[model samples]
Target: MLGYAAMNRTLREHDPPRRCNRDMRKKTWQRDGIERAAELTEQNFEDLYAILQWNLDHGIYLYRCSSTLVPWNSQFELRELPNYERIASLAESCGDLIEANGMRLTFHPSHWCKLASESTDTVERSVESVEHHGRWLDLLGLPRSPRYGINVHIGAHYGDKAATADRFCKVVDNLPPRARARLVVENDDKESLWSVSELVEEVADEVQIPVTFDYHHHSFSAREHSYREAFALARETWGDVRPVTHYSEPARLHGDFDARPQEHAEHVAAVPAWLRAESDVMIESHGKEESLLRIQT
Candidate 1:
């Protein structure tokens, strides 16, 4: 099944604009506190349910939910929300819809989540980030499996790949089951960063978690492997579950010649047939769900 990340354009065009990723600035959160978070979280969950239903109706069953589904989630526990019961109900309903339809739902936390950071404080915050994502899946009542994955990228090397991988695995081993059971790491987009083979040998082999192949990222961090070869290696780490792969064209190749190599385009023309058949391909273009719609037609 093919998918898109957050923000459904068609739904966002509705009367009230239906998107789930509501957020607040740190200053705003400090002033308004939990009350504001409660408000946004409630709206986010409501919109999230609507977004999932909209996706299923359009033949898109896979999605990466926004990390900001609960604004300021890292500051406190999910149960601490002022409208905890209502928020939880919304989330459970969303999960029921997903489970009933066999849809695939996942979360990719922000880029700051570096489980292998050199600083103890950085690593702590990173762990919190991943844990919250797991808690979200738990709230949705999704199974504790990679099929409902909480994917992330060990995007930084901090000048030492071996040590970084070691620290990352150590953290993964100790994560709360809600997070650890659903965690899957993705290959990075820089040659100096982690590659599919490197993640498979270092992280996946060490932690027993799956690897998510990123087709666009592979070219930059190919490590001498072809796309099919890298994807196959990542696929094996998934065990019985189908691996998730990110597919997109660089903005440079998609008409913006001056754009950075890592920049994704507004729309991806298509997904390779094998990727569409063997794995769930997330169309990581700027157009979000609209990109997938264009591809489908």
Candidate 2:
């Protein structure tokens, strides 16, 4: 099965704009007034349901959800605001619908999460970000498994790849069980850092963490690894669960293909010859669902 990331902007998009409230937007933590907050939360649930239902109806069973469902979420004072039970009920219903239809759901938190950072503050914030995503999965009643993989990239190499990966494992070891259970690492887009082969040798091979292979990253990095080798390394870590791969073409804004190698184009890349027919892949192009449908057809 194939999936696309976040919302399908090319498709009908509906969003309720943020409203004015007593909420303070600054260095400190504060929340919008309860009544206003509840309205926003309800809006989020409705938007998600609309996207999920649309995907099912249109024959796209796999989808990725945005991590910012609740603004200023865990840092704020609001938890179960105006109608906690009601929203939780709705979230579970959404989960049931996905499971009933055999849809695959995924979450990709922001790349700013760097658990391997040498700074104590960076590590703390990273842990919080990961926990927030895990909590959302809980609200949706999704099982803590690769079926709803929470994918993230290991951050900057910090001049010592081995030490950085070791720090990553240590931080991951202490994660809340639910967050740890859903965690999966992807090879970074930068060539000088963690390539697919290096990632397997350093982290996934040792800790049994699932590896999400990104073909664009591997290509841009100038790595000699083949798609078959990449798929084998990732699939071994995943075991019976289907391994996920990412596909994207480079967007050219200037001189040549190398100008913006890391940026995803607004359309699908050609389906590679080695892509396993039974494997699950997610389109990372800027066109979102439009790119995904293009490649599938």
Candidate 3:
């Protein structure tokens, strides 16, 4: 099945502009505290249910939810939200739709989450970021597994590949079962950074985590492996589960020759047949659900 990331253009253009990524700035969070977070979180949760229902209605079951589903959740326990009960009830409703219809929902925490950072504070914050995402999935009552994966990239090499990966593996080994079981790493988009083969050998091989293949990133960091070869290696990491792959055409390829190679096109023309056949490909194009809809035709 094809999937789309956080936004849904069609829904966003609706009367009140439905969206699940409602968020607050730092000053706003500080001024209002948990109450404000509770309000936004409730709204976000409610819209998330709407979004999921829309996806199921459109036959797009794979969704990547926003990390801010519950804003400022890392600052306090989810139970501390004034509307926690209502929020939990709403989440269960979304989960029911997901499970009853065999849908898959996932989260990709922001790029700042760097578990492999040399600084202890950054690593701690990163761990919290990942754990909070896992907690959200739990509240939604999804099974604790990679199927509802929390995908991430080890975005930095920190000048020492061996040491960096060592830190990453240790952190993964120590994460609570909630985050650990659902963690999946992705190949990076810079040549100097991680490739699928490197992740397969360094991280997944050591920590038993699945590797998510990003099609656009492969060209930047192929590490001498063909796309099929890299994908096959990443696929092996998923074990019994269907591997998840991210697909997007570069905007440059889509006629904006000046656009960066990593910039996603507004909409993808078509997905490769083999990728559609084997994995749940999340269309990373800017078109979101509309992109999936276009290719479906």
Candidate 4:
């Protein structure tokens, strides 16, 4: 009986009551927003290239490059395709296509686990990796493209949330101003300490870094927090900067596995008019074709 009571007490402590205040209920809109979208699949570079071409033809302005298609990881040396110059030329060609269509490209590092071992402390390493990649982009002259940026998650729950936020700020501060300006931090799944509100508040207060309003992460991480509340917080934190936002279907088990493709238009409808007025939204759905169709419809 004592053991049972103790277990119940532990569970109660872990699952605290939700806090939803009236101030958090306001509707907000993003100003001069853009409908950015990504082509996500387990597909290879050729498929991604074809999808890019299609999006270009259709006048879609924003796209995300799959990390798998780029040489992002330094741990395992994968086989070189043709030549380093070819890879650079390919990226330049893609850049030209996007420029011709008046589009932008954004990249997300493959999950923290894939970037380095689970044992590796990702907070510091993630920032280092960003800086490293920023240098590569500078070398390739890709950052000079009309719009290009890297999106990353708030660090995993290592210790105190406040301490992690401080570390994150320090890392962001260390980068060159131009590179720092291009970095957009995103909220992660429920298991991470930096939920949507937490990330927005911390970045705004500490780093003065912009937030990426990821709809699925907001829904998954703060299940009790309404979408209106999430939008309000995002607007309050990062104002006027036309944030790069992501939208996807909520994962069932709180991990990377997306259960179904997000209905982009339906999700957009749910977005309060206020948020729509101020932010550039990106659809990160499972199947690109269907997701884009939904957005169009």
Best by TM-score: 3
Q: List the residue pairs that clash in candidate 2.
A: none
- Please give, for residues 1-297, the per-residue lDDT of candidate 4 as tens digits: 000000111112323411110011112113211110011111223344444565555555666654444333333222232344444554556556655665666667646721212344664566556655454445335653214667777656556677667666776787775467667677775645467678777776676666667766676577467876776676565555455666555444335354442232322223334444566556654444344444553
User: What's model 4's lDDT at 271?
Assistant: 33
Model 4 segments more than 4 A misplaced: 1-50, 72-82, 113-125, 144-147, 176-179, 221-225, 235-241, 251-277
Shift of residue 147 alpha carbon in model 4, Å? 4.8
Candidate 3: worst-modelled 10 consecutive residues by lDDT: 288-297
Query: What is the C-alpha local distance difference test score of each model?
Result: 0.92, 0.76, 0.94, 0.50
Question: What TM-scores do the predictions have?
Answer: 0.98, 0.89, 0.99, 0.63
Return the lDDT, model 2, position 231.
Answer: 70
Query: Candidate 2's residue-wise lDDT over 171-199, tens digit each?
Result: 98899977888899988887777878777
Of the two candidates 2 and 4, the one with more favorable TM-score, higher being better, is 2
Among these predicted structures, which one has the highest lDDT? 3
Which residue pairs in candidate 1 collide?
none
